[model samples]
Target: MKDSEADSRSHKPCVPFGRIAVLGAGSWGTALASILARNGHDVRLWARRPALAEAINKTGMNGDYLADVPLPESLTATASIAEALADVDAVLMVTPSSTLRAMCEAIKPHLPDAAPIALACKGVERGTGYLLSEVVTDALPGHPVGCVSGPTFAREAALDHPTAATVAFPFSYEDRLNPEKSPAARLAMSLSGGGFRPYVSDDLVGVEVGGAVKNVIAIACGMMSGAGFAENTRAALITRGIDEMKLLAQALGGKRETVTGLSGAGDLTLTCSSTTSRNMSLGFQLGQGTARAACFEGRPVVVEGEVNSVSVTELAARVGVSMPICETVNAVLHDGADLRAAFTALWARPIEAEPYALELSLAHPSPNLPLQFGDT
Candidate 1:
């Protein structure tokens, strides 16, 4: 196909974006890199360990994550942050939530002043209780940051299965100084691979909170499955899960509509129904005869819901949103409450109205204008 024809086919308004960096070598990062490379962008997958980078370069695969999934030849793996970020237009960060702050700090000196970042992590920070975007903006102030979230599983996405996600910009992406360049628009184009649909949203909080909290609810569902409960039990957990997710999102200044969109309801459904979910799997083992220590002893992947249970519960409490399911999960996980006892406590709570009521106010948007990023 002609270059112009290819560009048109790819749905991008402009020419190719040079050297896009994915700042993590985990399953999600590797998968995203493969998609971007197939779209004809120069893509780099960053690994902290040099051996992992070398392995990917030599084997044409990421055995640790993708398990023999063939990677695109156009994708390159690198250990050097400078090598990945230098001359890059945009970056997608799939790092663990705990490491996001540190990773951004390390990438800051090498990052272009106006480079937009799209974070794929799905957990809030521990202790301080910051969302992924809050962590990003705090570390890289003045930079444009967005989030990619929904029901996407990295393995499915890598296999080119049909998948969809939300691309959220908390701040405006179009430059006030130069109206022609919108980094979010360009980044969305670069991320849309075959069978992967990217929908745009301005509800960053709703998108992110949905992504972060669904895993917690999924764990509760897993316990139901593992304990030999029927589908009615699972359905109830999912129903209550959405209610809490919406309440938490709105309490944090996000809209109700965004909470009900792809990132919220879609992701919750996917996570709750499948044992493929890391958090659900972990919860399954817990609900069965296995101990928590035994369940996670040799697990290689991060069970984000395990972490989010604590953070989300805390965030809701501080913000005055009631989430009994999340609180029950937290108690079971951390406070050593017996699984049966935890369930009983939740079951015995005083019943309220069908939906919760709360006074929610959105944060005043940042006064910063869009920063120039991609080629004009």
Candidate 2:
């Protein structure tokens, strides 16, 4: 096992005693709520549907999302946003990115003034092209905002399988050095224990970008897999996909190392390789000649990649970054471009030097002009 993975699995019981409100009782939200409850925090999971909330409250199970996994008896469910947010020490926003702003607005009246808010949802806002953290910050100004992201699958995490995530906040250098003194660290402590580990970071932008962009890349990898491509093809797509992620992250004022860390490369690797991922599964279905409408005909859960492909691509374009894979995914999913033709065109583009090498050359241009050298 990797040292990081091993470190994440080591038992560390530093959970702060408090009440945590987890908004959006979907699969991911429910799983996270379960983790907090198991760690001895008083966790309340909020479901939009009153019936779902009632069911979970009575039966200790979320039938719609996590039908098989039984929730902790200590955990409770509520349909009222006010009830969930009342007197909570911390809040975790796990709703879909498309609806994150509305959720934030709903909780504005009830959210505790000093309670820290952490986003577990992954996607760039559709119409605004804003990061999820940005939406939260806009909605709840003056509150400490952070995000938790990584390669965690909800079911595995709920079942106590070892899972590690990066918990990030916009910390100053001093705050980064003394993470334990910040709200982000307190939030991270709440998420730690019971085999679920969280590493604290100050690169909030990088963590958010990594979590959001990986879904788009996962869709590309899924399309390749569903279209009968071999491992070599998937490997190539993943490697190039990291380049696109790093470029986008760096362009957005995030560190490149953060992109290469858990939230970026780690999340991409897991999402691309697993059909359990909603984004990957959707892409696989599309690649297998299924109509996009047919793919979502019965599925009730939100497929982030389908939505993020558009926003991520648009954001990249606005920043003048080239992200062909994300652009191709967007075209196929939303712009009515043929899947096979898109892949073909993507692969047929003129080969250039690696992105890193290109970046190096751009940063340090040659002093002598070609004409000057020839004249000399």
Candidate 3:
């Protein structure tokens, strides 16, 4: 609620799109669908399961992910991928990282050419180590792609809590939602309202990296907290976590300052500090002496950091970017490294007088301007 249209997007004419297709009926998708519908957009939620779609349509709530949160009455759902995509002006891809490629493929044949899409998934490809945009661009080439990421939790968003995100595109708040408006502008206008704000940026890679790395760091924070480590330890992890994230982003050719913007700094602050985070919760359980199998046994939830730890470490290694915190998280998650040992190893590294000092550009420290994504 803090980010009014005037507060985030610069003055630009905009018009609302009529029909929006939201792929993925999970908590995040449903929450966003409700937000858009509440703003008077005709929105359809695409569910993989027919029963889930029927349940949402009948009860106006997602039985699996969001039991108590009420959804907008006009919000609809369908199991047919083509039906969901038919005549829709925009697409909101909200599936998890594991299913992103499949979801993209499923929707590809149904999507109109040059249709605008905004992805909600985070993390690198499990084996390919490609960003979500990269994967999507390969699947839906020539369709203008963008993304939104920040400190938004599905439950909080459903509760109408204030949530702001970083988005990319050539459109602006000044762009009237005309038929000719850019995909970024239409997607932003479609999702804006009800305490949800979007801060536009062209650094989609930076935003994606920020979302991916923070989950890994949040796991470390949870481990430290569960093990009864002091706040100082958690602070150290978060501080170093951002430093490594910035390094990785820069190595990938993203602007250096993207690491400090909404996706990077804001998202890290939210994920690393929250005890309720899925990744943090898993780490806390591990730190509390629970076995990995016990922690995830029978749980259907997806932990972005669990996989991102591997992908990010591999990415950093390939580019020779030293990501000690990320590497340590991957170790604890996969290599059975002791949590305390990883922390100790991190501390043992030679201390630098100014670790974060770099030749960062002063032109734009944040994506508050109208820079277009994929336009470097």
Best by lDDT: 2
Model 1 steric clash total: 0
Residue-level lDDT of model 3, residues 1-376, one tens digit each, is 5657558865657676789899999888988888889889999899999999999999988989899998889999999999999998888899988889998888888998777888887888877889888899988898878787888888898878889887764344553344336666567777788788877676777888888899999998887777767578788888888898888888887876988988888888888777668888888777776888778665666888998899889988888998888888899889989776676666666545554555332332333332221212
Q: What is candidate 1's CA lDDT for residue 148? A: 85
Q: Give the alpha carbon lDDT tens digit for every residue of 199-303 in model 1.
A: 877788999999988999999988767766758878998888888988989999998788788899999899888888888888887877588778866665578
Cα deviation of 254 in candidate 3 (Å)?
Answer: 1.3
| Candidates in order: C-alpha RMSD to true structure | 11.2, 8.0, 9.3
* TM-score against truth, every candidate: 0.88, 0.90, 0.88
**lDDT score, candidate 3:** 0.81
Worst 10 residues of 2 by lDDT: 366-375
Q: How many backbone overlaps does candidate 3 show?
A: 12
Better of 2 and 3 by lDDT: 2
lDDT string for model 2 (1-376, tens) is 9999988884534446399999989999999999999988999899999999999989999999999999999999999999998899889999888888988888999998868899999989877889999999898997888898999999999999999999898886776666566777888888888889999888999999999989998988888787777688789888998888889899999998998888999999999998999888988888778877788666665789888999999999999999999999999988999887788777766656774567432222332222111113
**Which predicted model would earn the best TM-score?**
2
Which residue pairs overlap in candidate 1's backbone? none
On the 0 to 100 scale, the lDDT of residue 236 in model 3 is 84
